[model samples]
Target chain A: MPDAPLISVRELSKQFRTFKRREGVWGAIQNLVKRDYRTVQAVDRVTFEIQRGDMVGYIGPNGAGKSTTIKMLTGILVPTGGEIHSNGYVPWKQRRQYVKTIGVVFGQRTQLWWDIAVIESFKLLRKIYDVPQRDYDERMELFNAVLKLNDYLHTPVRKLSLGERMRCDLAAALLHNPPILFLDEPTIGLDVVAKDHIRQFLKEINQRYRTTVLLTTHDLDDIEELCKRIMIIDHGRLLYDGPLALLKQKLLRTKQVKFVVKDSEQAARIAVLEKDGRKIEAVDHLTYRIVFDRAEVSTAELLRQILAEVEVRDLLIEDEPIEEIVKRIYAGEALKEVSA
Target chain B: MGPGVRKHVELLVAYAVQFIKVRLAYRADFLISTGASMLATAFAFGFLVVLFQKVPQLAGWKFEEVLFLYGFSLIPFGLFNVVSLNLYNFGNDFIIEGKFDRVLLRPVASLYQVIFEVFRIESLHEVVVGLLGVWLAASRLKLAWGPLEFVLLFFFALCGAVIYVAIFLMLTCVSFWVEDRVGVHPPVWNLIAFGRYPLSIYSGFVQFLLSWIIPFGFATYYPSVRLLGRPEFRVYAWLVPVVAATFLTMAIALWNRGVREYSSTGS
Candidate 1:
């Protein structure tokens, strides 16, 4: 049991039935007597397991069932089908006991009292979660050291800036030392510096306390910077769940290397020296760009051959942008689903 | 009590303390609102005074008796206002705006959290107003005052408050099934006005509706009658506790059903 996954979900699904309304006042009147309803499958048979110490990024477009999945896992929304077992309890059934082991933060909403000082909210939360006084003091010291919350600890939540409030909110969630942390866009609507500060705090908590963090974010940098494993969900279905490096490699096989040469004739010579799924193109007479599968031809070998043939002035190597692959996923282009 | 119950009680007290602290932050706003409510209570008492001038008694009940009933009713009504008035906004603020998600996320009972999150200290003035009315009426009527009578009066007040809370709690649970923000509470809440005067003043059907259906009679009129030593209403007076318990049980059942609905549909 100790080796069991901290969170396990099997064939989970949620369907919402909404009253469909027609356009204009006439439709509103007709809707009183007779109603039209539509059912939307918000989450469909998503199956995944999260280990105790893993920081996993859950990414999807808006309304792509990311929140729905998170809600089910957090025991906020009961699934219409399937079963979920987290921390040895069925999430929705034993919600009170299950929630004791998990902490959640929604970026757009605050759990703090708006008019109270930040420290008072923390004190109240300490009592609500029944955290030991010694643990509370220790966590406060740690959060203050890492998050620098002492700067705005006495400020009312309404008076604090977005970054300051977010820091306090993060500290509030960790006051109980919950084993699992669920963050819904925890760094949304913040400047680069603020976002980096939160990411650093999250990384510190995950490493220092071994807290399992499941983060859902629209910000791809959150995934690239924090997550070793990323899950791609689109239109209620989970398309991919595996290592980030494997996803980048499997979806876009070719790595592009740009070379700017002193001689113009070498550009033409390089374009025709293509074989397999490798090709070289001339941006102009003096520059050549080589596109080759990294698995088939290593970047160092390709660069060595090109350098030996021509006196290269400058060169740049770039992997396929994750944005390109994500956009393709959003556009309904199918990639063979990857499971971890 | 068991440790589990003690822990929840401690949490409830903590929630109440935080709520009162927040309310006290706006001292001027609290004073103005409390003053306004007291003024409204004064107007209600004034209307009764003006009515007594036109008629010596209402439906064979003297002005002193009616005043006592009105005062007694406010004791429980005020208690309900102080504790559970937020139930009136359960649908609009909690459900429609999706704030209930926060309530459910915590490691406590959702209903307990909802009940204590806000305290209407401003409405405490209504209970003061009720005490003043009772004092003034008892002096005028020269009623026999004893330890048993005072204890029974206190007991009735507690029962009245529970009944009112149960009634509103049941109405509030309707929001879980029907997503309307306005909900079905207002019309039912306005019906508390019937219990202010003597039930004899209303027709037979209104009397039945108040006695058996909503049971506002057990909260106010019957208790007032028993306090006055009316042999006719003696049986009804003892039924107050039973009525209160039955309604509270039903309200809690409805609340559990509503919570189940909320978890399943997430509305």
Candidate 2:
């Protein structure tokens, strides 16, 4: 039982049937009797598992079913087909009891009462989740220390700044000390400083309490900084699921190397070698940049070729940026490379 | 009581206290709304007085008897107002706007949280006004307050409130499918306008609709008739409890289905 995954999902799918409205008056009138409904497959057979202490990032483009998957996992929306067992409880069926074992935060919305003070909302959460007084106090202290909620804890939620409110929301979700945490864009629209604070707090909690976190975020830095593994979903299908490094390595076929040469003559000599998806550009009189497909040519061979032909002073090698890799994945280009 | 029930009760009390504090913070708004509600109730009473001046009786019912019926109807209406006006917003605020996500995130039942989240303290004026109208009508009609009558009145008011709650709950459930902000509750809600007067005033079909179909009449008319020592409606008066239980069961079943069909908006 201990070796079993803490959160397991098997072939989960959700299809939403929306009424397709028509254009003109005739179509509208016809819709009243024999309506037309179009079904959208929001989540298609998404399957993954998370260990008790693992922080996993669930990322996708807009309308890519990240929120739908998170919603199903959190028991807010039922899955049309498939199985989800978080802590051995079927989320939708055993909602009232299952929800007690997990905490969820939707970044776009605050669970806290708008008109009440931030502390009051926390207090309400404490009662709703039935947190022990001693435990509540301890968690509040820790959250205050890490999240820096002291300044706006007494202010009404509507009056707090976005960063302050997001911090309070994170604290509220944790007060119950749920073993599993589901966050959908928890750091959305936050400044860099606030985003760092939230990411730090998330990391600390995941390590200290062994809280299993399933985070869905558009912020790539959140994934880069916190998640060791990530699942990429798009068009309702799980595109890629593996270690973050492996995903980066798998999706990126090209590497860039910038070198400082002796003169424009060395740069011109290197520019002639541009072939087969490899392009060389001159920066100035003594510097040149070479982009080569890693599959066709290794970094060492390229370096050797450059060193053998030209007088190379200094060089730096860099992998493709994660943003571009993610963009390619979302646009359905990475699927071909990933499968191959 | 069990721990689970006790926890819910404690939470309800906490929400009520917090809501009162929030209401108190906006004293001017509270005072204006409360005064407006009082004036509305008085206007209703004033209409009744003017009508009695025009006609000695309505459909063989005296002004005092009709007043008692109107007052009795308010008991359930007030109860529904306090707890369930929020249900009217389920489609727009919770479903379309995705605020229901917060409710489902909690460990409590969704309905329980929604009902208590925004307790309408201001609507308690309806119950106070109802009590005043009942007291005034009872004095004018010289209605005796026997133990059976008092107990019957309590059940009538309680069951009557349950009926309205059930009806509104079913109406609110329509939002789960329709996905519209403006609910299908208003037209049905206006049906309550007929329940305060005697069913005899309406045509036979409307009476049948009130008695059997929608059943708001059982909440006010049948119970009032039976309380006034009218033997004809005694059987219908006892059926009030039965009607309430049946409708509530249907409403809860519908609500459960609605929850299952809940497809949350894209975030």
Candidate 3:
């Protein structure tokens, strides 16, 4: 009925068994005879579905299994349990064929040959993927225009800067025209201008190609600019999966309203309006702050009442920062805060 | 060839070309490595010559026969180094640095991709030196050559190379099980040392171990004995291809199992 989502993962899990060695020389000697191992559940029964042409952000704290999930989806790691069907193929089972349908960029590493020119690397990839000559040229032209890769096309990969290397990697990943793209911190160590260039290029590519993009990044700006759907995982479990706007509204309910009143009379009038769970705090003689739950009182109603009774000089409204909301979510407090 | 096979071959050629270009960028390093390999081969040849001067024969084998065995052994070992040296870097470059993910992410068989990623073209000089040594020995021995013998020699040399490659792959696959122990090239070097001389010189148990257990003897000693028309060793000379194929299959199986067990490094 839903056209079979492009990426369907159900109850996926991965467990890693790591040895716990003793600290001292005596303990090490004992370990030679008998070793102890501890099994860590890196990913635990996490489930989500991504429709075609959707751009989703996968975020979690460090060691929260974000990269582990990406690894399994890209067929680089096999899952310990559960099922993942990405573009009609089981990722780890049908790796060679499945990888042809998806493009992956790992920011920490370069896929290009370290000693070869950027163009030679692309040519090798074309042969490896068996992309036709015409399609390869077309993609190269498009990438050159968008990423401006021509400047460093003949330069060896090891000679390029971090931003230039990342740009080339992104272009290389998309040359095959895969239906899905997985970017793991594609802008990890980039400057402001470089970050903007990458973010814009990604936005354009998703729009023009209708590529389903699943991004894992610590940069909230990357998520805010590109991903409409957000999935947050913590402790190897999926904590939340929904629209970004809904997450912001659900987890962050309080809105701070700042009012600069013309006189003390106007400020006194604003104090009377602060009843029924609304909070009012004074900044200076003329400036006042009002904190209110959006669900309890509409900002427009409060503003209307204030404007009618007091002479306001200036006003500003601020919502909670997404960083703070995410922090709370990772802290295991968002659910309780939402219910209360 | 079918388009699929042609494409893979073309990819391998492209990788070779790129690697050559990279090597050329470091012209001094390239020259130094080639010179080092040449010197090493020359020294080994010198060692054999000096030993033969002291004694007319080693065990039951003559000087030319021993030289032929040593020369034959170098052909496969050199080829193995040229083609599969990257497999030796599995621990440091691939596992520790997490570069193996690049191999897995490609839309090709991981082993096939790695096999062709880098070509050690400097080792080709070893093959040249080996052919020269074999020609000199054969001319001195006045050996009778026939068409079937030539064919057997060709296949035996190929099977020998496959055995070396298989052994290297299997040894490197140990990295999948244990961390901090990927330097398998030294052990492989020691194993190849056993093949540079006739197995007849060793004790019976050592010969048995090399012939059956590890099969380095199949690559050199048995092939030399067959080429020389030695009667006793001729019976088992045909086992060269069999041993190569079996060991190669087992090595590939072990490598695939290692891939399945590969957890990858870091987050």
DockQ winner: 1
Residue-level lDDT of model 2, residues A278-321, one tens digit each, is 66777777877887778888899888887888888899998877
List candidate 3 segments past 4 Å from native: A22-33, A253-316, A336-340, B263-267
True contacts kept of each: 0.72, 0.72, 0.74
Q: What are the per-residue Cα lDDT tens digits for candidate 3 across A1-340?
A: 6688999999999988877877776975676678787889999999999999999999999999999999999999889899999999998889999999999999999989999999999999998888999999999998998899999999999999999999999999998999999999999999988899998988888989999999999998899999899999999998888888888988886787888998777766776666676677888989988877777879898888778877889999888778888998887785743333
* lDDT of candidate 2 at residue B107, scale 0 to 100: 83
Reference-based lDDT, residue A244, model 2: 91
Q: Which stretches of candidate 1 lie over 4 Å from their true place?
A: A22-33, A253-316, A337-340
For candidate 2, what is the lDDT?
Answer: 0.87
TM-score of 1: 0.90
TM-score of chain A of 1: 0.83
Q: How well is each residue in B3-112 modelled by candidate 1, as lDDT tens digits? A: 77988888878777877887788889988998899899999999999999999988888899889989988999998899886698899888987888888889988888
Docking class of 3: medium
Residues A1-340, candidate 1: write the lDDT tens digits. 4678989999999999878766666975676667778899999999999999999999999999998898899998899999999888898999999888999998888888888889988988898898999999999999999899998898889998888888998998889999999999999999899899999999999999999999999888898999999998888999888998888877775688998986766655665457566667878888778877767888899888888877788999999778877888788776765443
Provide the interface RMSD of candidate 3 in angstroms, 1 decimal place: 2.2
TM-score of chain B of each: 0.96, 0.95, 0.95
Looking at model 3, the pairs that clash are none
Every model's DockQ: 0.60, 0.54, 0.53
**Across residues B40-141, which tens digit of lDDT does each residue of candidate 3 receive?**
999999999999899998888889988988888888878888987778887778877788888899988888887888889998887888878887888899
